[model samples]
Target: MTDDKSTIGQLPDFDTLANSLIEEGVLTVAPSELHGMLSGQLAAGARFDPDTLLRVVAELMDLDILNGENIKLILLELYQTTLAQLQSTEFSLQLLMPDDVHQLEQRADALGGWCSGFLSGFGLYAARHAKLSEEVTETLHDLAQIAQIAAESEAAGDEDEADLMEVYEYVRMAALLVFTECNPEPDDTDEKQPLLH
Candidate 1:
């Protein structure tokens, strides 16, 4: 558990984004919200949801929290509380680890590729409501790579496979959210409106 906390903390923030999501060509993400989601303290119900969390993130980006570091005290507080809450759960999510790093990496890579394709629809889908920002689209691609690498099932001794699975679940959920956003389906009765660009 100590190792999991430390490992999670050590993961780097997506700070290399130079241009805003507007520059990314597709605008599915707000750079700031992603920063908070990816970097800052994990909040309750923080799992990526297109209309909810990502939208909040976009607002955060427009508000400039995306660029400013919010990990100083906020993330720490959230982490501790969230950790405690998670630990208190009756049953926790479990991850299974592969015996070999090479095998695990192979699996992660394949998963990542699929995830990347799924995420691409958010910006490119014909019905996606928002035009993807160039920076956010590129960043999400970068995220797909990081998520793939992070999905490696084998890690240093004492690292739990279950932890990795949990992390991967988060990654998958985020990717799916982006995909759905890009390719949203309209109501059965509502008039057709095209948001896809």
Candidate 2:
């Protein structure tokens, strides 16, 4: 067996300017910064700004890397996505529905499952450990509020889809972070085996 002192990843700095943009994305943040970040994600002819861009489009494949508990990393991705949406003129954020809300909720639940397993697997002392239950409990309530607004909008048959993906992305990222925390390794080799389960 390997020694119990392995350092997997950094405790991400939430101060990342990118996260600020995404968290602010659901709301209005400093727009110039977002404009620049979005420009960086685009190909040639994109007009945002070179100084503040962020691009690693290749992430979608290994994206399964995020499970549920790497809150900070997820936040970073959320920040980047926020920039992308803000940069897209064709995008709209005011036309969400019950279906979208339900899907987001499912995503949240999946994250919770991963978190539970992670905490169980890590014994609460590993670097990836997260008190996901609390963070998720709090976040879910606020998300419900957003869902209500969306359901009402849907009832009225409106189609704004305004900034919904931003919120959804946050939940998704949060899930990924939690998954990361709970699942420090891709294989089950280092996982602590329980005598009872």
Best-performing candidate as measured by lDDT: 1
Task: Name the lDDT value of residue 188 in candidate 1.
Answer: 62
| Model 1 Cα lDDT, one tens digit per residue, 92-174 | 31111222443444445434433443343232332323455565466466666655565454443334445545556765444
Alpha-carbon TM-score of each model against the true structure: 0.31, 0.25
Error of 1 at 32 (Å): 29
Roughly what TM-score does model 1 have, to 2 decimal places? Answer: 0.31
Per-residue lDDT, model 2, residue 95, is: 12
lDDT of each: 0.37, 0.32
RMSD of each: 18.3, 18.1
lDDT of 2: 0.32
